[model samples]
Target chain A: MSEFDLIGRYFAALGPERSDVVLGVGDDCALLEIPAGQTLAVSIDTLASGVHFFADCDPEHIGHKSLAVGLSDLAAMGAEPAWATLALTLPESDENWIRAFATGFGRLASAHGMRLVGGDTTRGPLSVAVQVHGLVPTGAAIRRSGARPGEAIFVSGTLGDAGLALRRKLAGEPVAPELWHRLECPEPRVALGRHLRGIASAMIDLSDGLAGDLGHILAASAVGAELELERLPLTSWVAEVVAATDDWSLPLASGDDYELCFCVPPAHIPVVERLSETLGLTLTQVGWIRSDAGLDVRRPDGGQLRMPARGYDHFPAANDGAD
Target chain B: MSEFDLIGRYFAALGPERSDVVLGVGDDCALLEIPAGQTLAVSIDTLASGVHFFADCDPEHIGHKSLAVGLSDLAAMGAEPAWATLALTLPESDENWIRAFATGFGRLASAHGMRLVGGDTTRGPLSVAVQVHGLVPTGAAIRRSGARPGEAIFVSGTLGDAGLALRRKLAGEPVAPELWHRLECPEPRVALGRHLRGIASAMIDLSDGLAGDLGHILAASAVGAELELERLPLTSWVAEVVAATDDWSLPLASGDDYELCFCVPPAHIPVVERLSETLGLTLTQVGWIRSDAGLDVRRPDGGQLRMPARGYDHFPAANDGAD
Candidate 1:
């Protein structure tokens, strides 16, 4: 069958039905109605085989990660999920692979109330490009430049399991099943982001590690930060691994965590603590924004510890990942 | 430099400024404000290195064509272009190539009053995926299912030059300069499309040849069509080539013309004729919609001609490019 026909049969019906979608699949363009007094949030991400995932990884996992990455961006902006479009390139037409991928994609899409509107399929090396569209109240989006000096820095969920899992898998070492799952399907904190829309002063999603991503907020806000190393949240698996190996860098500088790192005024700590308990999720206070102009990692004894300036660089040779 | 640094230096400044864009580059997500009473129109298209164009083709042309394809879908929907996001994947970082590409992309974006909101850059086999968003009046979008019997069929501009140019280039034959230009930089009829918003009964853009694309409209409308072979608008170059080769199929079955094929009530023909004169474009009366359930091409001598059922399929071995 033709690529177009294959898409219509396997992927068209995957999109959830919605009233706001005036036009969906089978049209040149999809029409969406954005309510008055709302702003549309847009982000795009592309994941390539071998570079973004193992070539032999499950197609379902690939699909989940592809959409999750884009949604994570929406979450960081405190936007409610709405619609998405996928541009998929495949090496060949494989029916089984397509079916499994669509299942994974549809499951997450339906859960978040996002609908697939339009996309194109082409022939090439395997890669998935997803563009997500969401809506937020006008002027209510959490921005990277809104943090101020004396604000407390916060991070949602645990960190470093995905990077650790990747390292162990690459080195031919067996990893715990929980760590493996973390690597395969990281959760995006969409609900927490929505709840924090007016409370958090600044926010970002940690796809490229906590240190590097926080550095973006600092640079954009023109402030500095001092992170408490002992307070950095880690999963049991990551903590055990770090204690045995005497390496604290993975949780601090690893990539692909997909958690939200945000900032709030110091006076709002009590409210945030209550929110963390209510959600049954760990919201760790790891640092504080400062008036100075550089980042510092502080030890329990109040001394500074030497660390790398940044995180995983896609172009490792240039060490350019540091902001 | 890292992928992020390369993007910051090259593409971060490519987007033009607009008031509706609440946020642009360097954010987790870009924020856009859709005006009240307007619907957002979305479309996506991807171009692979070898599948869509020559692997070593000019980066400038690739950039222009990539955005143009997505813009064409918006044009077919009769939406006014507003914003676009690009997800670019490259085999390696080449500063010169990146500069040329941004120049081409930014030029077209400025002309159409569209802003580049946000996107991701990744390392992989070369591909360019663009998602375009536009605004249209709610409930007034032109759709493929609106055609009725006895309506006059209209096509904007000439067709088949891109496909003909592709064939010549593949065969290593000398092609006319105008034909080569048409293949590389076909224009999207955005202005004409906006003008035909309420006038056209059904509308679609010609991407995969007239025969195959029109079939989409026929299937959606549950109708058939009959075309006059001699009435098709062809450029001087295409006409000369057809006369010498006796090949009418090029204009009928070739793809990538990027022209509009629309249907209008017979009574509205005079208004459209005036529109064509005012716009300085040739809007030819190519055919008419019918109540029957099959497509037909009539010769000048009033005889039916046999033609292929569809046009170029991506998969030639399976003849899947044909509709």
Candidate 2:
């Protein structure tokens, strides 16, 4: 079968049932009927080999991670995903690789109720881009600039697992199978985002490490913060993984953790805990939004914590002195 | 400067008014507020070096053509383009190349009232993918499956100019500058599409040649058609250019013509003419939908105009055994 035919079979299965999706994947252009009271949320992300992912990574993991990254955007906005479009470029047409990648992508998409509406598949070096669309009620969506000086910063789930997993993979260590899965398929906090929609003031997904991603909220809102290093909700597994390594800094600064880091007024922390219980999601308070213009760090001994400040920069480290 | 910084300087200038774009290019996700009574029409296209374009073509042309191809999709759906997301892959960052490309792309996008809402730029072999979204009234979309057997087939503007331009460029022929511009910067029929919203029964953009693109409408509607050679509206320039060639076959079979090809019921002919007058877009009657299972072409002498039945196929072309 031709590439179009192959996509027709598998790609159309990614859309979730929505009133606006009048026509789904089988056309020249996808037709959508935006309902009366909703705004569309759109995000596009592309992962390229040697920059975003390893050249020799499994194709299935690559497919899964691409979808997760796009979904992470919807999570940031507290929007319910409606549809997704995929553009896949491959070095060459290999039937086995395409099949595995499609299957992996389909599994994750189905799990999240995302429909594949339309896309283009072409010949090129391996890269995948997913453009995701979601619907949020008008005037109700969270944004990065909504945080206030008195707000408390919170993050869903633990960080550093993905970063540590990448470290293990890069070092050719005999990492646990779970570590590989965490590195390959980090979950975007979709359900948590939906549940926290009305409560969170500012929200963003942690793709560029906690420090950098949090910095976005600060920069956008014109505020800064102080985070207690001991209060960071690192999983025991992450602690163990880092304890085995001489340098665990990358786990704190490297990226690919598809978790939600958000802020809420201190008065809403009770409501946040209540929503977390209702959704069965963990909400950890890590820092406080401050009126100051720079980031500060605190340690468990009540002393100031000093560490190198660095995160994922799109350019090489020489330009920013990141390494 | 890195790719992101480059986007910040040049490409970001095409953004819409802040009020119009609820969320703009710098966010993790961009949000668009669809007015109370609008539907979204979306299409995606990928252009890869040595596949969709020549390896040494001007980067400016490539960028312009990429946006034009996606805009053509909106034309097919009879929707007003409002936003576009660009995904660009580069082997290395070239400041001059990106600046020239952005200049061409931004000019075209602004002309069509499309905002560069968001996109991703990455390091890889050169590739460009664009996803465009347009708005239409509720329940007023023109789709490829809506044509009936007796509908009239029409094409906007001329066909095969881009293909001929490519041929001339390949042969290093000195063609008129206008023809080269047509090849590089073909316009998408946005206003014509909006005028045709309720009149066109089935529609598709002519990117994959007339025969192949018409095949999409036929396959979707479960009908077929015949074309009258004498009625084909080949431009005078194309006729002059191809007069010495073996045939004017590429005019009907070669791809990359961004004009809109659509079907309308015979009764809507007056409406189409009025639309053409109002929008200043040509509406030429090229053929008619048929009940037959396959396509047929009639010659001027009432003989068979036996053109080769082919379109842009990705796989290697097997010898047809005609010899």
TM-score of chain B of each: 0.96, 0.92
Task: Looking at model 1 chain A, report the run of 10 residues with the lowest lDDT sum.
Answer: A305-314
Give the per-residue lDDT of model 2 (tens digit) for B277-316.
Answer: 8877788988899887666777666876543334565532
What local lDDT score does residue A17 receive in model 2, on the 0 to 100 scale?
Answer: 66
* Chain A TM value for model 1: 0.96
Clashing pairs in 2: A14-A114, A14-A115, A14-A116, A15-A115, A15-A116
Assign candidate 2 its CAPRI class. medium
Give the top-scoring candidate (TM-score). 1
Candidate 1 local lDDT, A233-311, one digit each (tens): 9888888877887666678888889999999998888888988998888999999999987789886568896444465
TM-scores of the models, in the order given: 0.97, 0.93
The best candidate by lDDT is 1
**Residue A83, candidate 2: C-alpha displacement in angstroms:** 0.6
Residue A259, candidate 1: alpha-carbon lDDT? 93
Error of 2 at A218 (Å): 0.6
